[model samples]
Structure formats: C-alpha cells, structure tokens
Target: MGGRRRHARPASADDLLSQLGRLTARVREEIEVQRARVELAEALQRGMLPSTLPTAPGLRVAARYAPARSGLDIGGDWYDGFRLSDGTLAFSVGDVQGHDVEAAAYMGQVRIVLRAVAAMGAADPGEILRTTNDLLVATDNPLFATCLFLRFDPRTWTVRTSRAGHTGAVWARADGMCGVIEHAEEEIGLPLAVMAGEAYPVTEYRFTQPGALALLTDGVVEGPRFPLEEGLAAVARVLRDGVAEEPETLADRVMEVAECTGHSDDAAVLVLSHDGPEACQTAGAAPGIV
Candidate 1:
C-alpha cells in the first residue's frame, strides 16, 4: 500500500481532434449569426428613418437625427414633412421606445398612418394622436410613441402645434424673447398604442409673422448636466450666438452643440423658422449659427 499505481484510460487523439474541429465550426456559425443580426438591426433602424425628407412648398423645414450611442439604439426618432392634398404642410417629430427591428417597422407604420390622419385637414395635434391611436389599438404589442405635430397653412405664416408625451417646444421670436409652450393642458395625454379610446385635446399656440418655433424630442432638451431648462437655454443661446442663417446651418449648429455638450442620448431636433415676406429674400442669416 506504500506506492499506489494510478490507472489511466488511453487518450483518443482523433476523437479529441474531432471535438476541437466541431467546436471551431460552432463558434464560426455563432459569429456569422451575430453579424447577420447586426446587419438586420441596422437595416430596421434605417428603415424607420426617412429615406429622404419630403419637400413642402411655402415652408422651410430642417431636421437633424442622432442615433443613440450604438447604431442599434436608433430607437424611433423620426421627422415627417406631410404634404396634405389641400395644400397644407404638416410636420411631426416622434420617438419610439426601441431601436430593434420591430420598433423601426412600427415607426414606419405610425408615420404613414399619422400623416394620413393629420392630412385629413384636421390640423389638430391631439386629433392626429387620437386617430393614430385608433389605428394602433389593433396592434397587440402596440409600441408607444411621443410626437409633436405642427401644421402650417401657407395662407397664414402662423403655425399650430400640439405635443404628445414629448418635450415642450421653444419659440424664440424675431424680437429675441424665448417662450416655452408647455405641452397643452393636453400635453399630458397618453401616447399612442396605449389607450385607444382615450380622448386627446389639442391646445393651439399661434406664431406671429417672423416667428420661429422649435419642435424636438426629450433627447434634445435633456442633454448632459442640464435639465430641460438648461438644454433649452443652451439652444436659445446657440441660436442667438450670432452665426447661422441657412436653415441647414441652424439645424447643424444645434446638433453639434448638443453633441459637444456630451449629450449621449440620441439627439434629434427639428427647427422651423418662419421669415415673413421681408426676410424671405435672404433667409441665410446667422444669429443661429454654431
């Protein structure tokens, strides 16, 4: 018993090799699967966004979209320039919860249906919400969405807007005053896809000629280190920073400011500046530049 002998089974080299080979194959397949999932996810997110923004006569619209840190967090941020059959221009900005394919797909569906509802000459933000809600109530997993809908009738430079669960809008007049239109008393209305029968009332806010209104998601107003108020002040400060005039330049300035300030969330901003007949000839001025 002093020296015990250990019994051992003969090793099977070929069997071990086969096992290693199978493991490698399995890993390769898994990688491929992951790659495909990413590709599909990107496609879905891209699909949710507009392939090309629509053009509406007598209206100048500019938008900037930023996906969350990863492309996958793309979520449901979207901007639509709706052209009604009656010659009205409708614009909306919305955010859905997920960046997955389903969110992207539903985002597309919501935009189409909502645009139709808003185009019915019912320029009510609340009405658009209600009608869109009716259609989505049928969806079992109906996703949730927050939107700010604005409609402008070239007949009048005045624009009417309604907000859902989204952030309130800031209108900085040509005279240099900044006012936040609290989401209508109706701003508290539930988002679409939740309660189908819920009644949403539209609170109307009018912009005088030569006024500018900004419609945006929380991502814009809730940037790093700043609550809604700070983010908004930043926006106004940047807008009045003495430099951007072209519609595109204004949009770019806001986006860059948000990004530079460490706004990690997907930031999207849609700014509409209405220049009365006087400023129309040269809309390219930069008190709004970055």
Candidate 2:
C-alpha cells in the first residue's frame, strides 16, 4: 500500500499578530475616550465655582481655587460668595468625599441646594446647612461633604458662621496676631449626609479691630508628611507677618505657603476683611475675581 502523504498544519503567526494589533488599537481608543471624559469633568467643576465675588458695602473678598496636580483628577473642593437682598454676604467652602466625576456632580447639587436655601431667607448658616443635609438625605445621595458657611453683615460688622466637620476658619487681627477659630466639641457637628437628622450649630464672631477671616478646605492644612497642627502653625506665622493689603494678595500668600510646604491635595482660600471703624476712610477695591 502507498504511504500516506505527510500533511502540514497552517502557520498561525499572522493571525496572532493581527489579533494583537486589534487589541492594541482598541486599548488606545479607549484611553482617548477616558481622557476626553476627564477633561469634560474638569471643565464642569470649574464652571460650578464662583466666577466673581460680590462686593459687600464694607468688606473686601477674594478667593482662590486650585485643582490637584494629578491631571484630570479634579476633586470636590469649592468656594462661593453672594450678596442676599437683605444685605447679607453669604460665603461657603466645602469638600465632598471623592475625587471623581460623580463627586463633582454631587458637589454641584449640594452647592445649588445651599444657595437656594440661603436665598430663601434662611439667615442662619446652620439652618441652611441643616436644610441642605435634609435634601441630600431625602434624595438618598450617598456622598457626604464637610462645609463651612458664613453670613457676614456688612452693616453691623458681625459674622455668623457654621461648620460641619470642616477645618476651622483663620483670622488675622489688625494688631498682627493670627490664629484658628476654636469651637466647643459639642458645637462642631458631623459632616453632612452622615445621618438624615443632623443639626449644625452656629458661631458668631464680631470684629472689634481691622482684621480678615479666611475660610479654607482641609487640603490647605492636611498633607502626607505634615500634621494638621503644624500646617495651622505655619499659616498662623504667615498671618502674623501680616497678610497683604489686597484680598487677592492675601489669598495668594496663603496658597503660596501651602505650595511651598508640598501639599499634595487641592487647596482653596476665601478671605473677607474689614478696615474697622478706625480705618473706615480707606475704600475697598472694586468687585473682582481670581
């Protein structure tokens, strides 16, 4: 009988190369899509912040917002200031518990609710925070945020402030002494969304001298290698040296300190200052944004 002809299997090298090429192309395409999404998210977050700070009759306001160094990893840090019809200057600073698109979206919702509640004639900062917390709980939002709200009465030169598990406000008096605002343990409330029925208490600070109040996010004082107290001490030193006369300049100085200390997270600072009765002759600059 004739020997069976030897048979050879076809080579698969070309097919393998083709499959690898398709996979590489698909991965590149997906990366581009993700990059685009991140860029859009960053833009949205920037848009949500205050474009221009309102001009109060007797106060100068300046604010700064900086994103994290990680490209497109925009966090939930935010600052806002607006004048109510009743002549109350309302300002706020907050940080949601995330660094993604969803966090940014939730931040927008929280900001809107707070603004709406404040505009609805809720003069108390604590009440606005409580109402916002209730709305978040009612909507079943899973995100939580730490915030500081302030209502400054330019006419009376008094400030009513509230905090929800946020960093304390800092102040520099005309005498060049600066320190962090302290609250009783019972006065400091939990962060919003921790529970549905949380209540935040309000604190009042009346300025008797020419001074400035700074509301900031924890990123300013919390870092990988730095302790919160150490960061706060550094800030106090800067303030003791006397901040710049201009609000924007003071904001820049605070951020400069944060950057020089190698802070890794986003930092925001909002400053409101008054000349007091002694220096009432000096006029505040026109409305501005930074």
Candidate 3:
C-alpha cells in the first residue's frame, strides 16, 4: 500500500476555536478603545459649562447656547454670572484660544481659576481683567482669550463695563432704541495672555431705569461666508424691536432667527433687563420654543 502522506487530524477543532477567539478579542478591544474615546470627549465637553449662574437680588438671567450641529465646537467660549463675595452681581463672557476637546477642558479650568481671581480681585471690572491676563500669561498653556466683564447694580441700574479684546454688546432702552455700548477711548485689543500685567480700562453706563442688554459672542453673528458687520447689523435690527418687557422672550426670538437664518456656529444670547416684576412675570411666556 502506498504510504499516504500523514495528515495531522486537520488542526484540532479546539486549536481552530482558540485562533477565532483571539481574533474576536482583538476586535472587541478596538471597539472598547473607540467607545472610551467618545465618552471621554463628551464628558470633557460637559465640563465646559459653569455649574450654576448666581442669582443676585432683583436679577433675572436667561442664557442659551447651542454648539455646532456635529457637537464638538466647545471652542473656549464661556459665560459666567455670580454674586461676588462683595455683594455685587458679576458677569463675564469670554472666548478662549482654540476650539477642540482640549480647548474646552482648558476653557473650564480658565473659567474657574479666573473666577476665583476675579472674585478676589474685588468688584473692579478692570482689575479683574488685568489679573486674569497675568494668570493666563503665567499658565502652562499660555492660552489667550477676549472677554468682557460687567458689574451692574440692580438697585441703581448702573453697569460698570470692562472690555479686553471682545465684540462689544448693545443696550436697548424702554424707548424703542438701541446702540452698541462703547467704552472710553482706548485701543480695544491685545488678547489677555499676550501681555502679562497690562492694565485694562473700565467704563460705566447707567440706564435711567431697568431695560434690556444683549450680549453676544462673535459666533452669534459670524459664520462661514457671513459678513460679520452685516450679521451684527442684523442683531442690531432684532434689538431695534426692543423687547424689554420680556427679555427671555427676546432672547428666544433672536436665537430663533440665528438658528433658522443666521450663521452656524456655537451661538449664545443673554438678555438681562431691569424691566422689573412685570417683565419677569411675562418672561416665562416669552413665546414657546422647544
């Protein structure tokens, strides 16, 4: 009989099964890594926001923000409001150095650290900014940003304003008129992190009575091919309607226009009004929006 080439009992079924198991484990590990990456990114995104806005006496704040459609635009834009230890209502809006998960995380750190510095630096808006600038310059990332800090006394309707490289805000009165709030004559720039210990200036404005103030980030008005000046003009037009009786309503209306017709970027709108009790009552009714 011809010697049949010895064939090992086709590699044992057990060995074959082991090989398949190894392949399956590799795929599962890859998937796990992918999932972990996404979860980490999302958690980091959530960390970008302030835990809660401070509620000071006679104050009502309504703020809304939506990031890019695909969600990752955390770009260092942050808004913070609180009652300082000195009993003044403090608010700030800022945009940081970059746009990314890392940027957002850093933005949160900046927000908290700066808040501590601002709260401790006293209610002087300019001093708060000057200190923040020094801290930013000294930080490891050396990240820069543009910010506007305002301290307003509801009892008097007097607002102390400080601008450090940011788009200006607008104040709308009860008389159906509006205009950009301007600071004293001074160069408007030099991002915070660029110059350590540089002095920033502050200006003040008083609304004869409680009215509405609309503050925005560049993203609120500028996107893609949209001309910034034109977008800002559009914002001015909305404010022209002058919805002081219902700031939150006005906030929603303006946001609707942007989401429906304006540029696509991380957009935020805040309407702070001294419109008083009646306004707050109707504010909840500022038209329904999902």
Candidate 4:
C-alpha cells in the first residue's frame, strides 16, 4: 500500500502572516476597484441629467433624483427638461431596463439621442418618440427604456404628450384635484428599442386652468413593500394636497412620500407648475422623447 505524503504546513507564523497580508491586500485592491466603478457609474448618471432644469417665464420647474439604496450598481432613472428649437418646453422622465454601470451608460446614450432628435425640430410628441426609437434600434443596443415625453406649448396652454411603456404621469388641477393622466394606459406604446418602427400615439390635453404636472420614474411610486397603484395614489394625494406649494416645495413633498416608503429603487421627479396664462409669458419649446 502506498502511503500518501502529507504536505507540510507553514513552519512559521511569519509565513502564515505574510500570506494573510497578501490576501488582505488583494481584498483591499478589489474593494477599491469596486468603489471606483460605482463612482464612475454615478458620475455618468448625474452627467446625463440636466445640470439645472431649463426655465421659462410662467412655468416653475424643479427636479430631484435619488439612487438605489442597496445596489452596488446605479439605477437608470433620469429626468430632463429643456427648451426645443421651436421655442416650446420639452420634458421627459425615463427608466432604462437595468441597474448597472452599463445601464447608466446606455441611459446616457438614449438621453443624448433623444435630445438630438428633438433638437432637429420634431414638434409632435409621437414623431419625436418614433424617431428616437428608430435611432436607438439602429444601434442594436439590447437595453430598452420606458419614457414619458411631453411638449408644453405655453402659447396654447396645451400639452401634446406620448408615453412609451412608462409609468403614468400625474397632474393636479389648480383646485387641488389630481389623478394620473387620462387614458395613460391605453395610449402607451412599446418601450424604446423594442421595435424599430413602433408608433407612439399622441395624447393631447390643454391646461384649461392654472395647474401642475408631475413626471416620475416608477421608483417614486413603487417599492418592495408598496403596491404600484397604491404608491401612485399616494403620490397623487401628495400632489393634490400640496398643489399650493411652489414647484420646488411640491417636488420635495412628493419625494418625501417615496422616501417614507423606504423605496429601494432609483427615483426621479420633475414638477412643472403654472400660475396661469395671465401670470406667465408665452414661451414655446417643443418635442421630447423619453
């Protein structure tokens, strides 16, 4: 019978200590690498967002964002408001289908492409989304995003908007009544990058009175413990009760509701309010895709 030779363990504590030290160093290096990746991803995400929301007379706008609480990778929620070439204000909120560094990068690409296409003078919300979806599909990217796009015409006090598989937007009447946009579910198109030639039907509404609009990512409404419909109702309640607050204050109140729920996903909110046509100047900015 052949006896198996026993391998000798380290003869000295110093040798064991040296090996442990090497292992610790490797662990520390890995931690640093991970930290760097997280920082870079956050930078990419923040950079993609508007540094400051575009402003116009009569329209008070504000936006807020919070990253996911438990993930090493960042979420893909983003909100943007900017002036279009045609003098109309374009606003959007979107969530890319991922929670990683790659998702953040893809979000940047999608936001840039959407902005570019809108800048090309596409006034119709449906056409804006159609062009953006086509362009993103041409890139052959695997990620898709749900977006809500709104083109607000101060001239007419009307909003021509479109949804691409996004969470419904909320609006509040000047009298403190609020609800999710009418027929939001019925008009939703497939998320961007889902189909090359998808048509997003335009849903138009005129602000017959001084009112407020809210566009939010799902994180603002849904959480691990919160049902989606309940969350939406909660947010709408906040908007309805807080309609008298300034746009910034109202936005903060809406976010507070999400925070109270211990939401685990990334969140973004864009709030726009007008006192009325009498109080705000006629400014136009048109067309945005999520």
TM-score versus the correct structure, for each prediction:
0.78, 0.85, 0.75, 0.88
Candidate 2 lDDT, 77-196, residue by residue in tens = 899998887987899999998888888888888899999999899999999999888888888878899999988877766678889999988888767778888778888888888787
| Deviation from native of the Cα of residue 142 in model 3, angstroms | 4.3
lDDT of each: 0.67, 0.80, 0.67, 0.84
User: What is candidate 4's lDDT per residue for 194-276, written digit by digit as tens?
Assistant: 99989899887666556778899988888777888888888888877877789999899888878766787789999997756
Model 3, span 201-264: residue lDDT tens: 7777655534567777777767665566666666766766754556667677656656544554
Per-model clash counts, in order, read 5, 0, 0, 6
Model 3 compared with the native: what TM-score?
Answer: 0.75
Candidate 2 or 3, higher TM-score?
A: 2
Better of 3 and 4 by lDDT: 4
Candidate 1 per-residue lDDT over residues 216-287, each given as its tens digit: 777776756667788777777655552226557778877776665565556677777665554433454222
Q: How should the candidates be ordered by TM-score, best one leading?
A: 4, 2, 1, 3
* Runs off by more than 4 Å, candidate 4: 1-20, 184-186, 278-290
Better of 3 and 4 by TM-score: 4
